[model samples]
Target: MSYYVRERLPPRSTGIANRDQDRGRPAMQREVHLIGGTRSEAIRLAPVTLAMREAGLLQPVMIAAGKHTGTVTRTLAAFGLEPDITVEGTGNDTVEGTRTDNGDDPLLRELDELWSVRTPAAVIVQGDTTVSLAAALAAFWRRIPVVHLEAGVRSDDLSSPSAQEPDRRLLAQVASLHLAPTPLAAMNLLDERIAHTDVLVTGTTVLDATLAVTTRRTPFQNPAVAAARTGSTNRLVLITGYGSEAGGEPRMAAAARELAERHPDVDVVLAVHSGQVDALPGDSRVIVTGPLSYPDLSRLLCEAYLVVADSDGVAEEATAFGVPTLMPRDGGEPAASLTADCARAIGADTEAIVTAASALLTSRFRRDAMAAGNTPYGDGLAARRTAQAAAALLGLAPVPDAMPVSVPVLPSGAHA
Candidate 1:
């Protein structure tokens, strides 16, 4: 059964107002629009949407374009979130397929049409995806306030180095409020001449969502899932990558084979993207699988001895789990991964990855030392804080204390 089928959205008012002011009189609920399209954006928005729903402070109107339908579906389902509206079939191909030949133009038109008749008090968007930037622009055009989540992430040069940096900068220009994840991010916004009042350090929501997923309580039904649980002799080595170099399936296959060969005892799980599945290496030791659901991926990370990936989200999630990671990116690393040597940049060279994996695998002291360092991400309270800030911004009632996260507690006298 669909999780969203059980949850219903709250009533909405035309304008935002402070419900606290009208204690005796009934007050109308305001609608806060939350939009996302890509996998990363959807993952980050999960906690915020859940928070809004739990608080009942404001009615959240969820929106999405089908950029990553599977990922978006899994993530939203994990959090029991369903979009109030989707802009997929007005014109052009569905968001799940090709994103070329003026792909985003149709999305822009759809969003513009949505705003033409009914505009929310504010539009909340996450990350630097094209869909996010488009939504922010649409809200800005309608003179609706834009709330940018995970804002102020800077790349090497804002000259379209990876397409994300430019999108982030443009979103910053139009966003009325910027919820930066770190101090460096806040400083970046300030340096860009954004008002200090508009910028708030709410930490990253990814960690909050990552921590929320607990180990399965019931007996495993799937043989593959049951086998993925790490045993005494099994050391899990998880790999994920994107872009031209290591992101290619052939390159990832080679790296996986190399790692498996070097460490025969370790179990290598490679999360292959859909585009590169055809070239995946067929090896018994290396488990080649399609993109994992967020919960399953979180479970793997929690059990992984070492991670070799180029994704920023992977780096951040690995850091929160205290799992040592090898970043295969050529240039700069994400801010969360660059602390206490938690993540190391080794380019896309297969030899470098094997060497690093070997060193970390053999040296228990080294891995333990790095894992003990402070997480560059936030405490597990990012969702609550972000939700609180959003309520304050929207003039809604304050968010009540959130329920504590359910993690597996070790038996008394057992070490964490």
Candidate 2:
């Protein structure tokens, strides 16, 4: 038997120290490179790429997986921005590379090659995926500045035995510019001693993405949304779980049994990741579906009365879609604070989850308020603002102002 070690070497930030000494340098036109670990990052980057092109800033380059290359390419084409570079054969997604023990993986090598060839002035990496971390590392080694989108989220209980805590902590340390989505996220970054100057509250680009897609309405007008609009005879609850090790399967099972027993009229749909379908509970009412595209998921979300899951970013996505959500306590502190009506602390017993779901299904006032409260998180313009922020950071001429509105703070203990 052979043993292997999997570790990400700490990033080298001192690579550009001497270059910083050379002041009064002529302004140089810079390339804005996006390193995507998954299809979602590529999708999210589309609007930013369009906004950059419209602003006449540097052309954007996307580094994504071969499996997702076509999807990424088509998405960019829809937005009318062609990638200057595309790298393939990483795996099904970026997480494949992160979980691999080999430090000299081809994807990492490709990232290094991309950095060497493009030499971007600033690199924009969205979210906290493994690909983002790898790209940040590559940029740091090359002395290029890094801008992290959706930065500053924390779960605080790393010892609680969750994988996201390590991922988020590493991302925070590597990023040069932290583009946080909320004041709470910004505050979290500042408390971590990241300079206030380096952190900006840009709101969430996902919100912007959500608003743009939802406005189209054709998708929402489909049968699924219509069915959802009809309301569940028993409550229709959506539950999502990610990462096999994070207690997702067990939690979903436990919650399902409790809900089925306590509220037999309410139906529970478990949206298992395609990879984890075998783990799904065998209840007829506990419908198991594979992963869905954003638009399709948003449509489903529109119809869903409530969303239950342990996925970090999905809760906010649900909020943007005006779907009330209940998140496991382990999801993260930021999401918990944002979704008072739906969120319960991590250790929520089966009875507690059942109680929460029952309350949400019966209360018209709670549903209305939750739908109204989700407006601040995202309005589907994050891609546009993210584009502007990326351009400005690259020292390009300022993009025309289309800044998103500030998210309103929820009253303390309002959801509880």
Candidate 3:
């Protein structure tokens, strides 16, 4: 199922094109390439791959290296789709080593090889990572259409701390199709003058991923859940955030420590980012857990009394799970407005975190209401929907009733 594009001959263009024309179709056989370097990227790519497979499209080719590749391969295996091609470069370990003067590298070389061999109808790139940008450029150079997932997300301030504005801008300009998560995101693309015909508000594939994990129930529980349940009746606060070298880690740690100190009866679990686990503090009250599988992590969220994170997506997922969250507020906009009573924004200071934690601990009625307000982000069938959409774009047969899949929630403490 794997391929090396550089080593193979290009498929017969006349035959492929005529095949589509004869069937009064575009092309059923398409190639997808995902570019990124993180466990999160791997997780995000899974649903797309699943969607493609369910829609009868070709399995995707992944371009990544080092730990990132391993994580991606593992995620694909978890969903039962082996990559058709995996591209890794010699200098992939270092940023400078991986980049040439013109920004082309072994990864791009592999992509070129894949394109030559398959003549794929399109390529799908997700996120705002360097790999994605590079892949998009490569695809554009090759004259292949590119679909951008999670497009139209703008932080608005490129120079602001921890801003991904540049990547967002670059993606907005190059993407042929923009799969926006919300209507607002779609509007952002429209204001930027992107063709309206190219933008689609498909909710978020992440919500589909979240719902998929939540719907599955198993009796096997991890030790962490057992400990959390039997250890004490103390309030549980789950803290997560983006793990960039910016102030994200320190801010989360300081908040966790403050919550622990101010509320002795509470247990603060810091779900450290997979990249920054070593940076966490050594404190009994602040329990450190490794990066968990998505389903396992969702179950942990269900057990939590409150969740604290700076990530908007995590905050959204927490709300879907009915867990109240404390997010860092961007000046002027209260976090509650974005997430309802189930969520709030607090200062990174110890006093601010402690105060917010104390208030949530005391408000039983409010907590109950927020929990009730939580609903699955969408049906669990995002994978199928995305697959059908990508297939249609590629001129494949349309899948029927391609809506979100709905699944029942697992019992408390269920684990993979």
Candidate 4:
């Protein structure tokens, strides 16, 4: 029983919300199942949960379903959220696709049984994670409408190592509604022959999460991070990535060390993957620490003078905070961020990293000029638009206005 679109709103660009009608309804009765299993999912989806609740449209039944259960829970908590249901997953991250029957897999079996007991009207899956693949497939099997958040993102590079590219492509097949984060994404889906009406550009929810968390002014837990961030007159360079995803952690570490050494006042911090700590350069100035909680990470991004991101690219978040970022490898999503004026893909190596950082560091004019560019992500109401679209799919509300086409946002007093 797939929950098809009950009603689509009359095309209204500017309209007010229903103020008095059904204003006092209890939230639980309007259950909308949303699945999350990773920190990124939690961060991206938290704002949507809030928007839906505030709008009195749909109440999300957040189901914790993925690897990194602990991190996901903590990340959700930061956004004042907790999963209504937690499905302890048994599969690894390397699972190819969820198209096959995984009767033996405890995670898939659990999802199957859960939905069978009390089926949801729809299941909302975020991004292209293995968790999303499993959950989307399970929902499809049960004839549940799947709403794919952050839909239509594509990587041009076919040789990429991860299964993310394929996961999203498969998701496009079953999702009843596609919430594309940008116009480019919507175009990607349209190019694939997805119905124009099915795709909506909602901007990226990650920015919503970033904006909300930045206002909180959370304290950094890592002593090194805390000390480095506080009362520092010089620039703070924040680097993040996993060697497994981006390749050669050691080179990134070496680059950080070199950047720190060359610039007397500059300090480098690598909010690194746990496994790759030993592989990094052994330098006192380069503060290497484990992965940060989402809030802390957002705070660091806000405070960062410059961001040196590997494949676990923070360009979106960095760009959101008006921070200049340098991607160490080939460009991917949010290519607008990596444009010449703001961020750059300097090729993943020690020399490229050092050279780029040096250019930006020595020339404050260069760094400030880059940061002056407008955030290609949008004005930061992505979650709100997404909430409206999701509710509209279920006949709860009308669709919100689409985001503007992507263009260079030149801040006041910015250079060409």
Candidate 5:
């Protein structure tokens, strides 16, 4: 029998622990399933889990599954979270709208079995990844409402190498609630004919995660970062990426070479994909390392003098910390980077990178001013807003004291 066809059973508890006036009993818990398989998804979703717990709303059941299992494990650990359930998966594919292996088919089967066991009020999926697409599809098939977090991002162009565009498009269509991270993103959904009532500008959860760590004032945990922190004469420039146009190791190598030769006082740290390490510039000034743990990267961002990255996620992180960033590509950057004057979009070339870095490095006043500007990305309450939205959808009330303040959306066309 199809899982969706099973006889529906009344929930045992509301999980709220609140007294039911009519029945003079505590309500039953509403099971809200959150599924993710990648490190990025894990990092962004951790805050939402905390917010939901604090809100006394639907119970957030975290399920970790995907190729980047180790990274996912570490990110959740940094947030002091343990997954309630973990689906067995083994594929290294991170591209959206594409599967790494047939591994996810079994995962889909597992999800079906789960739904057969107990239907959840909703399933939450974040960002554009293969696992996200699978989770959304599986939940939709089971007739469970799919809440899409960080929805409606667009490069505005259809052509792309990866399946990110298609994955996002499909997920939006099936998503019962769209949590757009920006007004521009909301506009993207609206343009696609998604109802305005269903779309909301909640800001990016990444900012919430960033704020979580920064507020705690976590000590520097990575030795490389700590060494850089103590080197008063060595300015730290954190770099990350994998795309050829944006993060290609060749491009990273060129930029590293130029910076190392021109600015010997700066320490350039290139955090690249493990496979591409052999392609990077062999320079002492360029500290080529494997992928960093979430906390390590957070600490590096907190203390880095400047950030030069090709990935949008890294840009968001740097902007959150008020660190100046130089995007090595022309487009596909978040609006906050430009609006906050915290980042510059430089074409993916050695000279453009070198020029931008040199200018930012020489101007201490400029960097400080960028850091002090209002964070155009978020105000550290996205997770709360997200939880509240989910609660409304599930017919559950959130804790009144933990309600989120209204966050203004950016003007349309800011990043399109």
Candidate 6:
């Protein structure tokens, strides 16, 4: 799942901290190989790479690693990055953009082989995808330090139908540095007996990407989606990426149809994850489309009246824009998935969704109050903090101040 390439650095096998004290080594020998994940997760690491490269403290090797070649490549290109080494899966190896198991054993072996020849000083990974876990394992096996970006995120409901839950927990075992997105996430690592110094609360990096892309507006490819933003009487209930868990599930679709029926004035755009279109509602007001490009998605969030999503990263984005968001998981979401201000954890039941939807729709004050809440996500400085943490892990420079993150206000209770 992970793709890796170096800047032709002479492979240094581990012992990075010791090597740092050595007389000036070429920047290549200080290579910090960053493995690219999905577009959402990859953008989080993008700022870190740019920071590191700009500092000239360590060689930032951007590697594109994912099943969806086009998606991965496009994401890298978004930040003016192209993987020095690109790994593409063909035949049964490849999968759609959404994360589902695509046999990472081969990725493990491939990374193992690459590192055996030319090892990076440290390997950086993001989130809890197979690509992140595989990169961590491969780096760990070689005694290379693994820097985990967005570490210590755990779902409130283990039975919440997300496949990547365990991957984050297991990642903590192998990671040398945990760049937790929130103080709550950092506390989760500390509770597990991880060293206090090893965890840095950097806030979520998605906001950085979101803020950057929001400046660039693009016409939505689907006319229906574009129309949702323009109509004065129409409110956009943007449902982003039902995710791998929502496939063949009628509950969400049924809920969407009911919401459409209840509110004839609003436009409900169901931007579904690829390969899960079969479960879409049959209502005319519920405009269904495949996954949206990052720019289009950002534009929708800016223009949306309300948001409903299950993808873990959208919570951060919704918070960034102060958009009132509803997490549809029945078990609720982790602390990172909700903000103090505008988000609520509404379960997957049809009636519950409709009730929450109706309340948000009927009351302008409620929606505005949610929007007025302070963003729990970062003030867009997470990447700079993350870059400093990665450098400090190599003993090259001091990590920038660990920005304070407020403990998330969970609906039922704290995720901690």
All models: lDDT? 0.69, 0.60, 0.60, 0.74, 0.72, 0.70
- TM-score ranking, best first: 4, 1, 5, 6, 3, 2
Superior candidate under TM-score, 2 versus 5: 5
The Cα error of candidate 5 at residue 65, in Å, is 1.8
| Candidate 5 per-residue C-alpha lDDT over 109-205 given as tens digits, one digit per residue, 9 for 90 to 100 | 6676666565677899999877888888888887788999989987755566566787799999899999987666788999999998888788788
Residue 379 of model 2 has an lDDT of 49
Q: Give a tens-digit lDDT track for model 2, residues 65-98.
A: 4446666665555334555556664532335223
lDDT of 4 by residue, 1-416 (tens): 21112122111111112212223444335556788888888888888889878887676777787557677778899989877777876644753322333335556667877777556667899998778888888888877779999899888654555667877899999899999877777889999999998998888888888888878777886787788667777677888876433455777777888888899788788777745655344566678877777777787777778888864336788777777888877545356565434677777778888899899889988888888776767667888998888878877777778887653442211121
Model 3 bad stretches (over 4 Å) = 1-28, 57-67, 80-82, 90-106, 160-163, 218-226, 230-235, 242-266, 273-286, 329-342, 368-379, 397-416
Pairs of residues at least 3 apart in sequence or in different chains that clash in candidate 3: 5-113, 380-405, 381-404, 381-405
Cα lDDT of model 1 by residue, 370-406, tens digit? 6666666666667777777777776655533322232
Clashing pairs in 4: none
Model 5, C-alpha of 360: deviation from truth (Å): 1.2
Query: Residue-wise lDDT of candidate 6 within 82-126, one digit each (tens)?
Result: 776765533122144334555546667777777776567789999
TM-score for all predictions? 0.83, 0.72, 0.76, 0.85, 0.81, 0.81
Distance from true location, Cα of 191 in model 1, Å: 0.8
| Order by lDDT, highest first | 4, 5, 6, 1, 3, 2
- Residue 172 displacement (Å), model 2: 4.1
